[model samples]
Target: MKPLDPRLLRRARGARVFLAASVLIGVASGVLIVVQAVLLAHGITGVVLRGSGVSGVALGLALVVAGRALLVWAQEVVAQRAAAAVKSTLRRQVLEHSLKLGPVWLSGERSSALTTLLTKGLDDLDPYFARYLPQLVLASTVPAGVIGWMATGDLIAAGTVLVTLPLIPIFMALIGWATQARSRRRQHALAVLAHHFADVVGGLTTLKLFGRAKAQESAVRRVTDQHRAASMGSLRLAFLSSFALELLASISVALVAVGVGLRLVDGKLGLETALMVLILAPEAYLPLRQVGLQFHASADGVAASEEVFRVLETPLPMRGDRTDVPDLRVSPLQLYDVTVRYTGRDEPALDGFDLELRPGEVVALTGPSGAGKSTALAVLLGFVEPERGVVVAGGSAADEFDPIEWRRQFAWVPQRPGLRLGSIADNVRLGRPTASDDEVRLALLTAGAGELALDKPVGEQGQLLSGGQQRRVALARALLTNAPVLLLDEPTAGLDPDAEAAVISGLRATGRTVLMVAHRPALIAAADRTVSVGARELVNA
Candidate 1:
């Protein structure tokens, strides 16, 4: 992204407002700076050349200095607030758009990377908004105003500033390119380290069981060393750039000072006018120098925001505006000639896959692993769009109904359920947040989890519960939804025979249109009919 990316203004309303306010503040600051310099120059001339009394000029000088300080404080306040607002807006948009993209797309992304981007990555933008951007605005406004004011006093100083000012930005651009590259490298290193650490933590138990936990020490050390090296490299470049900008600005200002001093020695210029020109010379170069320095601080943030924009710009699947979906209790659901090919896969996940689901019947999809049984469920749930076919519901295409509204018709139980850190009752209530305690208990009983207490705590991802217990809680949550259709993937896999029997009995009792992926003979036997998938043609048994 550029120093001032227009996409930011388009994506974040706060950025546009901040920009406008910064412009106004920058102009006001410039006016104050010029007035302060004029007063100081006059006071110095009177004291040294005319030997005039200091009473009048002293009060005005004090007021102008205080006003300038107040303006600086105001800029700080506005910049901080704007940074907070923009970060909040960007975070919300990224999260919302990720959900809209659905699980299939997210499956390909690293959760750790996304987490780091949302947290530490976006937080880096604070310096960009709070320091770099304000300086950038000042660089544009203050230089021109200072130069123009100087011109009215001494054209020689003004012309000298005009010729030297462009050099700062020119050097800034060249150095900025290198700084941005370093920043990007550092950011990438940080993300890689974060992803590796998360993976190690998540699978630490398995690693220890295999006696490979110790082996990861070297790997982690390697990644950490890489990140440290990148960070140091970026810091070195920042220091060098700051030094270079300071040197350039000092030389530029010294040139103006030299000429004014020489002319004053020759009696070619008034002392007051010479002092004013000299005082304002450094002011012209100050903003640009600060911009160069702050740019390094904001570089990481710029790189992070570019990644955020890429995600926000990704296109979502086509969904209709229609909210009036037909009732799943009576409507027939059908997938006609649907084909889905995932990236980097030679074979399509689903090819010419056709299926029909009738109302109030338990239909089992039995297929070998990698046969796209879960993919079929995803298609029906509107989580994946078929590349070459359409889903029909009650004689209307599925895409014709809004995806959110359409998903409301079915309760889904994936192979691995996501449970939060909460009580069993809290997790169950997720299916229907307003469900009463009794309703939750009943659902748990029906799903063969009646032995578990409602207030029992489940740690993150239900780690506190046994595998079978976690499955039952997920089943209970799905059962509590009271939707017209049930989509289950290996719902009975982790259950004991008795528990499986209880769950199958519950499904029969509910009489909802059920479609489940089943590998167990018991699950297949429980279905009213079974369809054998992955064959040249689907076979009904």
Candidate 2:
């Protein structure tokens, strides 16, 4: 990726404004640099050549110092805002894209990797935008301004600067190329380490039970050691590059200083001009030197964004955007020869599958494993597209309805609810954020979780809850939505007999259109119609 990727400014709204501000700040800093250099040089000349008291220019010097300090503070503030804006924008974009990709796409990816990318990967971009990017702008504007000013005073010193200034960038490019590969390697190693650590920690209990915890410890140690070594290698290269840039800047300033000294000795240059040229010479190289230092700090962030962009660029599957459709609550839905085949799989998940769901009817999809029960559910939820046929809702094609609006009609409860770390009420209120405590309590009672308190904490993925409690809480969340249609997958698979009977009874009493994948006899018995998927036909049971 380029140091300042144009795509970031184009996609992130606040970043464009931040860049413009950075350029303006750079110009102001440059002007101050020139003003301060000239004033300091004049004061020195007065004291050395005219034997004047320090009081003559002390106030002017103080004012200039104050102005420079103010500019530095403003620049820092703007840089921090820019970094925050860019990170927030990118994080949002990545998450939205992931959601759009649907559950099928996510199934192939590791949860830990996705989590790390969204959190730590995006966070590392802070230094790049906050520090390196501002220096990049300053590197361009400040040196040019300093050189232009020096030219008016002494052409020879200015000409010397012009000659040696190019060498700093030349060396920068060469060293940057050498360090880039190493930086990328280090970033990859760090990502691997993070992914492995998250995976191990997430399943630590399972590892302990299986007596593989000791073996996993050795694996973790190996990856950690590899990351450490890679980090050291990257730092060594970064230090060398910094050294090269600093050495080049120092040499350039020395050449300019030598030219000014010789001119002053020959009486062609005044003391003030010689002193000003010397003072401004190092300032000309300062921005570029700083850019080199900051570039290394932001390398990991840049590498992480490369993956972000890749995901963002992936094509989304076609879905209808039209919002006009009859009320799904009373609408009859029918699948006409729907077929779905996932990538990298030889057999079709759903082939020529057909089914109809009527309002207020409970339909159960029962089939062997991999017989397209879940795939059919995905089709109804607008998460998967069928290649061969169409789904009709209310005598109109499903494709004619807006995907987002269509999804709003259904309350879905998956086999695993994918609960976050929060209170039980928090999970229930997720689908209906503004739902009152009374409404939540009623929904919990309806879903047979009246015993669980709303304020009770559910640890990550509802670790604090038993299987029955987790399912009931998920059902409560679904009930909170009060959508016209209910789609559930294995809603009673893991529950005890009593809990399972209660769930089936609650589902039957809802009087809403219910579509579920179920293997349990009790759940199938509650359904108005049971359809088999494995026989390439719906066998009514």
Clashing pairs in 1: none
lDDT, candidate 1, at 13: 89
Model 1 CA deviation exceeding 4 Å by range: 344-346
Question: Which has the greatest lDDT?
Answer: 1
Candidate 2 lDDT over 410-462, as tens digits, reads 88988788778999999999979999999999888878788899999999889
**For candidate 1, which ten residues in a row score worst on lDDT?**
532-541
- Per-residue CA lDDT of model 1 for 234-291, tens digit only, reads 9999999899999999999999999999998999889999989988898999999999
Count clashes in each candidate, considering only residues at least 3 apart in sequence or on different chains: 0, 0
What TM-score fits each model? 0.96, 0.88
How large an RMSD does model 2 have?
3.2
Worst 10 residues of 2 by lDDT: 532-541
Residue pairs of candidate 2 with colliding backbone atoms:
none
- Cα error, candidate 1, residue 269 (Å): 2.3
After TM-score superposition, what is the CA distance of residue 173 in candidate 1 from its true location, in Å? 1.8
